[model samples]
Target: MDPADSHTDEIALSAEEFDAVRAALARVTSTGGGAQAHSLLAQWSALVDEVEEGYSWCAPELDNDLSCRNALAKVWPLLPSRVRAIRQPELDCIDVRYRRATIPWPDRPEEGARWWTWRVPRRLDVEAAERRDPDWPLGWEMMPFPRPASVEVVTWQYVPIRPSTKRM
Candidate 1:
């Protein structure tokens, strides 16, 4: 394990990673186990019964999805088994789903809108994709899960250029 992979009591990660890691840690500590996420990493002892190593909370994106993938990997080790963190890049948000909801989350990028739509993962009981509210930021979404199961979307507002790769 990279020492960098070892998170400490000091919250040293980038803001996005820190927010994500903390939120995930909240889930683990809340589970029946008498655990506390004093550090982003629960002791390896605490994870003995968890899913295999190199696990992450989000669905793995493709090799070329750079920025978010880098941040996601850093938070992966801290996640409890069964909570999935999903990325909706176009909307500049992340969606978290705990195992309690076992449906297929949305995989499609939203379409035909002036602003990006923030879609509740289909797997979730929440509403479908809709235009983002003013509070949604540019590049982050935090879901606390179970209690107030909902997404808080943060994104950088912009219109990205869609370069056509095919020869016209």
Candidate 2:
């Protein structure tokens, strides 16, 4: 992960992955596992804390979508086999479902809207998507899924973008 990405807002973990990390920590701590296990457990515990504080509780921007993926790539290989085997499919499932929800319409982008609206369908059930992956910085609709397609539509509103005050 980039050192600059350490901003609290840039960390994310899916609900299932967070739960798996907690469960693995509990098992390892209770078993009094050795040095390597303790090290891994500690790292995972910190990650859990970061995710809970950074993404779960805080309201993060939806436009940038790689925070969770970048964070996970660094830590995933270190996770225990059982946790890895169990969580991969669950995460993949969510990715698949969310991807389906985001297919675009075949027509050109709507007037006064960014390209995101083209990828994410109109009138998406935001609440249901949030329920599916509450850990996402924004709802699942904000995720940058691969290969958008043409899908149906619903109600949509176009809001004007404002300039940011913060200096880069």
Candidate 3:
């Protein structure tokens, strides 16, 4: 079902609960998150999804915006602390640099044959050559387009796509 179309019950929470969740997100974002920290972050993110299911904290009367969900969406993928997003024209997408990694950074040689490269949704696969940081957002993982096994797929599928009730 389209998330925008589903009408869920209001998420009930007190100020304290809100504060706790916010603090947890902040803590997870600011420190070297251990396994326990990652676990807490997962739960906290889920709470954000639940709380904003049918309501937005940014504007209470606003049915047009899902502010709470949007905030979590922005933060969840690119945890503010562990990764630095650098947009690279080479990859045609943002190359995420992890903290405490090598200094020379991504060792990929800038000079490469253009025909040998490809972009799968975002960054070129070559840019993600190193070991992935455990904390990197799931969405950051770029996969090969047109799987060798199934060469028939054509268009990309999207989620929560805007409905065409009013017509484009």
| RMSD per model, one decimal | 18.6, 17.0, 18.6
Query: Which candidate number has the best lDDT?
Result: 2
What ranges in model 2 sit over 4 Å off?
A: 1-60, 104-168
lDDT of 1 by residue, 94-157 (tens): 1211121122224534433211122232221112232234432222234222212343322233
lDDT of 1 at 50: 23
Give the per-residue Cα lDDT of candidate 3 at 125. Answer: 22
Ranking by lDDT: 2, 1, 3
What does candidate 2's lDDT look like per residue over 1-168, in tens digits?
532223232225577755655554444344322223224423434433333232222123322443334334444565656555545554444334334444444565533324333444322323222343323223444444532333222223446699999999
Off by over 4 Å in 3: 1-10, 29-146, 155-168
**Highest-TM-score candidate:** 2
lDDT of each: 0.31, 0.39, 0.29
5: Cα error in model 3, Å:
8.3
TM-score: model 3 vs. ground truth: 0.20
- Error at 39, model 3, angstroms: 19
